[model samples]
Target: MFSDSTITENETRRDLPAHLEQLLRTICFRIRVQGREALKNYSITAAQFDLLQRVYFNGPQTMTKLSQSLGIAKSTTSGLVTRLVRDGFLDRRRDETDRRVFTVAITPLGEQVIKSVIEMRVRYVEEVIKQIPEEKITLVHNALDILYEVMSPKQH
Candidate 1:
């Protein structure tokens, strides 16, 4: 099990917010620990999986869209996309309306891999949370909704 003892180390509770750091670490740790092996099955890393998921669910997208979705730089997303394209997980094409613009979509193989990964995730969640009551599931959703709202970026 992952230890969270360091979350209580800082007692200033003033200049620096310990809870925020702890929250970030805990979330990262959980994803790394829980999703590590699951990712290996698809020959992907966590970052790769995140990118692929964004594409699978919300693409055919421009590099800008992927950068924004992944919270990384456009250059970084471009590199990731390049590697994916090389691996045949995605295809890039110029937009007909604007030849200068490029977009990407999951290839058939990518779709199949993503589909399998999704099913694995669904089964994992069901098995892990099966003991929780339906009412608690609603509570979890409500809590996440609040968290999402709080963490949402401010629009310019």
Candidate 2:
């Protein structure tokens, strides 16, 4: 039951206990921390890693797009982009068709980090998953896949 325990389970989807939601959020945060630790020698922050991921997967982005995607202010995005540019991890160039607009692209160095970060994170998760029973692992994998598909926003 939720919403002061008055809402009936039949009123909506299965009752989602608040703790389960918090647990999922906590797991996500912990995994990101593990990734940050894996990147200790790269001198990059978690924010930078996340931004690099978004750009790497989605391609070059305008400052406005970056800010909106990263859920940060344009000024803050500027600082992050400036730092990445200074460190040779990202490049900023003016759009040829629209001189007033600027776009940011990940550099080779950034690409390398993206691969390493992904591999490192995958390996970390693998190590943890190995602890689970083989049969249960399959169930967990399938369940998580379903959960992701159900919870993720619809693609454009």
Candidate 3:
């Protein structure tokens, strides 16, 4: 008998809602694996590097704002912030107006590194897109636009 895992064989046998779920799963897996491989020379994981880029672009941010923007828990955000600060990529300071509020900013070195990483990522994306046909690229762009419309958050 085959031992059951968290996702049972029966669950796997059942039809998925659409290919979208499988496609997304495959994309996530491939991207994560390849991204790690690409980041081997970097001291941080791809995700940590991505967080650093976000902070460089839009920081001097509070813990809550960072958490929200990064779609992570506040504790997780704090941990990331601590690690970045340790890496000399971030500076943490109390808000001048609010003693209770802590904010994080990217270091100058972090900005330069992040800019390079962003360029590398853009080049990688361009290379991937180069494999697709022009018509297909247009279709993909249109589909993404529709997807954005469908999935956009509703304003209160």
TM-score of each: 0.59, 0.79, 0.62
Candidate 2 ranges with C-alpha deviation above 4 Å = 1-15, 153-156
lDDT of 1 by residue, 26-133 (tens): 755654465455566666656776788789999698888789878999888888888888888889999778899998888997787677666665666677578789
lDDT of each: 0.76, 0.86, 0.76
Span of ten consecutive residues with least summed lDDT in model 2: 9-18
Model 2 Cα lDDT, one tens digit per residue, 116-148: 877777888999898999889989899999998
The best-first sequence of candidates by TM-score reads 2, 3, 1
- Which residue runs does candidate 3 get wrong by more than 4 Å? 1-16, 32-38, 50-58, 63-80
Candidate 1: 10-residue stretch with minimal lDDT: 6-15
Q: Estimate, for each residue in 1-156, the C-alpha lDDT of model 3 and write its tens digit.
A: 455466675676674545577887886675455544545555776667878878877868888888898899988888888888898888999989999999888898677666665565666668878999988998988987997898899887
Model 2, residue pairs in steric clash: none
Q: After superposition, how far is residue 70 of candidate 3 from its true place, in Å?
A: 7.1
Cα lDDT, model 3, residue 131: 99
Off by over 4 Å in 1: 1-36, 129-156
- Which candidate, 2 or 3, has the higher TM-score? 2
